[model samples]
Target chain A: MEARNIKLEEIIRDENLVYTKTSLMTDKPLSFCPGCGHGVAHRVIMEVVDEMGIQADTIGVAPVGCSVLAYEFMNIDMQQASHGRAPAVATGIKRCWPDKYVFTYQGDGDLAAIGTAETIHACNRGENMAIFFVNNGIYGMTGGQMAPTTLPGMRSSTTPYGRDVALMGNPLKITELVAMLPGTCFVARHTVHTPLAVRKFKKAVRMAFENQKLNKGLSFIEIVSNCNSGWKMTPVQANKWMEENMLPYFPPGDIKVNGEMVSKTAKSE
Target chain B: MAKIKGAIVIDIEKCKGCELCLVACPTDVIRMEKKVNGKGYHFAYMEQPDNCTGCANCAVVCPDGVITVYRKKFED
Candidate 1:
């Protein structure tokens, strides 16, 4: 029992260290709820920036959502965009700084609802920037309201009786719609539920950054994350629910790689 | 032969006690502490660290990003 009392400072040795928090992230604690996916998503993105040696030459656009304060956590040049206007802001940043890596962090509500026009036009014009979309189904920040990406039959604050497809219309599959555009160079959907998923998502982010270096148009990555607080479940339960309900509709895979749509059967695991 | 050993450190105060790492860990190396942290949450700690493989699954899935893992190999 006493062995467990060993202080962290006493046990940490540089030579034996296999993993540590990336310095690219600020020391500030995350504002997300306990067990939310946004924290992991933020870490992976920062880790990729750190690994690519692009921290100094990268600019991020934060949308109006739970992660609106993303700039506070990520130690990089960041711009705060109005609701659903991240793509537009990112476009301006990319145009002004063509050589720098530019990206937008948007929630489903911000990207699919309010900023639909900006998102489509940006993708259609083949803006040389990365778009990181966090799709948590329901709106997390504004009190668990139904969003454009909310699943059918899912119970949200606005749809307490569960979303009726006939009345509410079908949930928007914006990722697939963006993939259909010819301007997108690398379009993929991923979730950060497990270690394997995190690895794949990290690779996708890395590829999106690399695509900017090659001037390969736009790279869009939709990360289907969990909103435990909004979903009315524990962190673990929400992930399980997402796997059973969310992943089926928005399967994690590369929708478009290098300007070509990945076939339905040949989607990467 | 080489014996691989791994250890982890958790910033107990930062931890939200979400237990995501507990589920992600393959070797069952982690367990929740009976004592509560300053936040009154049951934070995670290593209960059976000898089984850890330094796979980093726990750290990768941690929402709070509080866990740090280390590994080393010793000749037997």
Candidate 2:
């Protein structure tokens, strides 16, 4: 008999080598297309939850639209809210379980458009929770349509001829506008278009959770994300496009941190 | 490679004006200029030319595809 040489370790290994834990919880693999910023934002949220060691004590509220099914990927206790109702859901969660870390994950369509009222009221009231808003400029889940945050002159299904300010209006700067509110304890805008950018985004997400841990009121993050399918760009191009287009439109910085008015030069210790 | 006053340079067209460099720059040598580019975006310029340590933070955060920082040759 010929000596059989099979790479058993690589093929049929069932020891610790095969028991490597995945950072992402196994419920549903990401449905986001290649280069979608939603993936990056979701991953960052998970990383923060892990870093804070609050998986068991954390309650995440899912919004309608693209991230509506976020509960599938995140193994922690999750709640599904009505369209643009994440803030309201989050409010109930935090109040019902004051000791648990509460968070709301929303998309631009959910947070900026339909859910605008809920988001504003929640921030104004200084609800003790964290909000992650992903602004991809269009309503992705409902077939690429114009969103409140869709930039002027950017064509979408609803604004096929390119956005006309007179008719369609201009993009809404939800993050900056909300930062002006007095009740928000922490506010920042960031993106994950690059590796270094990812690091910074993670830092911001971590701070948001930290605030929740300390019960320091609400912390809001506006993530300048990408929707390659809607944008008609490849994953790589989408990232580059966001870097060149979106970041300029919204400069990244902590609008407010711990009630301290932070400027572009300020950094949280 | 020698002491030729090495500095950082930014490609303005690619810069998104995120100001990541300002935060990363240890010497506080960078700040966003009020003058908007043709693209309607702010460009980060040297606040104090001599303070730049060439750490490349601004280049890293630039979202608009702008930025390249480097030093001019010292006139010895």
Candidate 3:
């Protein structure tokens, strides 16, 4: 009997792959945790930019946090901003280059906490830029400290006993708050826990970038992600936990779409 | 109906062995290799290639962006 040997290159040449990694990503491996949603979010944004054919004209601002090194992973023109200052940097870049596509990749700790003022004012001023906010409910890079968006009764390094609304205040629904502002044209909350969720997230991200080309006001996309290392749960378990706990407080869907607030009934219907 | 075929190429060194892909694969074609990589983590491998439907669900969910999927099409 003769044994036949097949090479991987031949298989790749012969097969019709429906999906493959995008060139927008860098050769460097992502430094995010194994199950962290930050990588998925980064890939989605890069994929959107790649598909839109704006890699050369796109400029990304990454604030301090776990996503601080996003510039390394996203193969495009990028700038590093101080902690909680991506919006300010993005604003400046967008103002200087109105024709260029500018965006800010931020984390909950940077955007909702110390950068709160910048975030609110950037949207209020209707900065023509896309803001990708990754909300993991905890300070992932700072050893799982409680963030301003940390849900009530959630446990963190700072809130060991659990986040008490009376003591820690309620979770900040910054996405909804931004939706109320007139400057914001698109505001949506999404997750990356499942294939369906990832598809929806990609659509939202693409829409946010499209709105920028329309010269619409700010487009805020809040991705409710999980920090497995911070949460002290396996990646799979953390996703399950997020679906059960975080989804209720931060429901996944568009809070505002195309300058119109999507009512709760409309979201359900 | 024409039979559909799927295949995957994994960057072993890039895989963290998180097993997220294991759960993402709808057809259970993926599994963790017994051999560990340079990072001392088991890498993902195709245990049952024939079962893959080229859904790309595992690639979509992979945080490391290590998996690349391929599908073969047949005319009905």
Candidate 4:
């Protein structure tokens, strides 16, 4: 039998949708590059916010970076922070409105580099807020400079010779460092290269927000994302490279659950 | 026998044709359209609607968040 040509309107009218854009996202087209993980990461966070019915009470602090305009895309209360100052700004917001959900969305260069002091202090103080760090290894928005999380021997415009570990210090595992601190209650590193990974990331995001409601100190989520434009590769190639290179160095899994460090064996599972 | 039908609606204007959804679809239900959107990039379309299980894999992987998946149940 010949397959029927069904119209999309028919299905919509039938109301059998399995998936649709979250209401938390504005109608504005994402300014991110095509196939960039930032868009996926944004969607995952918005999806969680929408699902949890916390859009009104939730406030997001976007750091100075590619995501600086995040307030334009996310349909909620948002604040723009100076480079690497999102954590501190979030701390103020959460402190002012302890009952509200507060989060900081930051990038590698912003969070792990210049903002390292604020990030460390905020997590160490056990601020009752969520921190979403997008680690793409390089300064993507600022013309592909070396970032604190950039892997050794990784090539960036600033490190054209493929980062020489001898000249530059080793890549800083900021997430792991924060997890070791007593203030961080939940810490996880996730990616969005696959469907399963996106699901896992969403779960982590939701838990991070839930932690805020529980007043459970700090919840930090690091997404090891890809910078296809900065890496000078197509989206597919970037994802493949990230899987082969980034995954090994920054393994994706829960580092700390409920203020307890997860065993290495369970992390690999 | 029970027949299942699935469909994907692409917001043609919103799609950048990154093809992430194409690779994510387990049943190979999506293909890039020859026509480009306003952004001057090819948009995705349902190439084989019959095979779609509406698993939402394509939607999940879409960076642009432009695709919506729908499934219909019917008797054959």
Candidate 5:
């Protein structure tokens, strides 16, 4: 048994290590709820930064919502923006430090609702920065309030009986709306619930950062995530529900790439 | 042909027991521990280490980013 154990240790040596957590992530444990996509989202973005060897040059602006404490988990230089002002903050940072990479992290409540104007104007002006939008429909941080991205008939604390389209208006397809603007160079909607989807999200994140080097206009990535606690479902159930109900409405795809709209049929799954 | 093998190390203290890793794992190589961790959550562990492909699927889908994967090849 001792010899077998030694053999096992020999096989699991450091040289065989295929993957390890990126140093870009602080040793601090994530404060997000169990199974929340915020943690995964944070990981991929940091992974991209670490892979690009741009940790020192990258600055992240995180606004209010569950990710309000994003600076705590993300090891790079980070700035906190007021509720829904991450894009505007990012623009300021990018303008002052044109040589630096800048990005904003915002939730649906902060981005699609409270900061709609900032988000729109920044995209319209084609700010040379990346915007990472996490749209879980409901406001996960504020005890599950209804957000602008909340789907029709979706139930929330404010809409107990379910959101009435006539009263609540329609869920914002902000990704597509931004894609129509000429300022956005790359626009895509993604999720991080599965392995395949996570890989795609990572590529999108990398592309967003790379666009900054080319002076390409704003790159926006909308990650449709799940709010299990607010939705009163288990983590697994929330992802499934999101795949069924949310994906159909927000639909994952590259809305625009390199300033050209991707045809509907050619959309990547 | 050399035989390929894979293994995984999970940081139990950081695990929130969301179970997404289990769903994302293709080979059923991971399982939740019966005992809770310091956080009182049933953390994930390599239940069937021999079957792992080091594909990093579990690590990718892990919301907590607690899993690390390793792969090795041995001459037969």
Candidate 6:
């Protein structure tokens, strides 16, 4: 009965195998703060990276944020970039090690604010690497400050009275803006808020890495994550905030696919 | 066939007191209590009667390894 449940990998694409042992150990301690979305996102990415069999060739860049310890967590070769320089480092790594898979893990503030320049130009050059951006709507490590994706009227340290559009400016939809660039080929936004979403998110990550494996152009995935401690709300409220305020400003679906902008869910069985 | 009822089982040791699972529960049967667990994080408690459909939304987004759901019946 168990054998029947276990389908052979031969039936699946060599690149699309779903089940596999990951270097992510079961007993290893996770450094992420309790209720932090970075933990879940990291696991998802690690699972896909392992299943895709790219761990040996994959080089990752860790950004400056609550998840900076990512280098210590994932069992892969990685480097720590300055606050928002992950894209630049990733670009350099991809250029020098063209045969290797390159990626950067950045937070909303780091990628959408400080690293926006590097991110913009990387896609402009159509670099063959993936960028995994986590948009949790606030700066977690350096105290809870307003982030590029922080919703208007949301209470934050930098915006104690709530993010005012007239003063602080409207929230920046970073992923969509980057997708507008001509060089970006695969762009998508996903979340781990729901199991169904997690399943779909895995597919998106797999597709992004697949693009890189084939020397395809830049692929970006913006994940709507939760910041439980920083938000001062229970992890439940943080996720609820994402679904209520975030999905509208930063819709959770594929923004671009194969050089074409996809505004809606693709017709897939 | 005896239809099994779905339920949520939380790992108290890993619960970080993040109430995300409580809000995601459509049943509104869960709530955060004022007690901290072994991990020093506030933990949530099942408050509402039996609205839990065991959708596993709570387990899906849990940053901490706290919640798990088991469906009463096996899927085809």
Interface Cα RMSD of candidate 6: 9.2
Higher-DockQ candidate of 2 and 4: 4
What DockQ does each listed candidate score? Answer: 0.60, 0.02, 0.60, 0.72, 0.64, 0.21
Best-to-worst ranking by TM-score: 5, 4, 1, 3, 6, 2
Model 4 ranges off by over 4 Å = A1-10, A264-267
Model 6, residue A208: displacement in angstroms?
A: 0.8
Q: Clash pairs of candidate 6?
A: A235-B19, A235-B20, A236-B19, A236-B20, B17-B42
Q: Candidate 4 — which pairs collide?
A: none
Overlapping backbone residue pairs in candidate 4 total: 0
Poorest lDDT segment (10 consecutive residues) of candidate 5 chain A: A1-10
Taking all chains together, each candidate's TM-score versus the true structure is 0.96, 0.71, 0.95, 0.96, 0.96, 0.79
- Best model number under lDDT: 1
lDDT of 4: 0.89
lDDT of 2 by residue, A13-119 (tens): 23212111135454354566544667657766876788678888999999889888888877789999999999999999899999999999999999988989999
lDDT of 5 by residue, A1-269 (tens): 12222244655679988877889999899999999999999999999999999998999998999999999999999999999899999999999999999999999999999999999999999999999999999998889999999989999999999999999899988888888899999999999999999999999999999999999999999999999999999899999999999998888889899999994542446
Model 2 misplaced regions, further than 4 Å: A1-24, A264-269, B1-76
Write the residue-wise lDDT of candidate 5 on B1-76 in tens digits: 5666777888999999999999998999988899999989999988877677789899998887898888877664
Candidate 4 structure quality by residue, lDDT tens digits, A1-269: 43365555556644798898898999999999888999999999999999999999999999898899999999999999999999999989988999999999999999999999999999999999999999999998889999998888999999998888889989988898999899999999999978988998999999998888898899999998899999999888899999899888888899999999894432544
lDDT of 3 by residue, A105-214 (tens): 99998999999999999999999999999999999998999999999999999999999999889999888898999999999888887888899999998998899999
* iRMSD values, candidates in order: 2.8, 18.1, 2.9, 1.5, 2.5, 9.2
For candidate 2, give the DockQ: 0.02
Global Cα lDDT for candidate 6: 0.77
For candidate 3, give the docking quality class from DockQ: medium
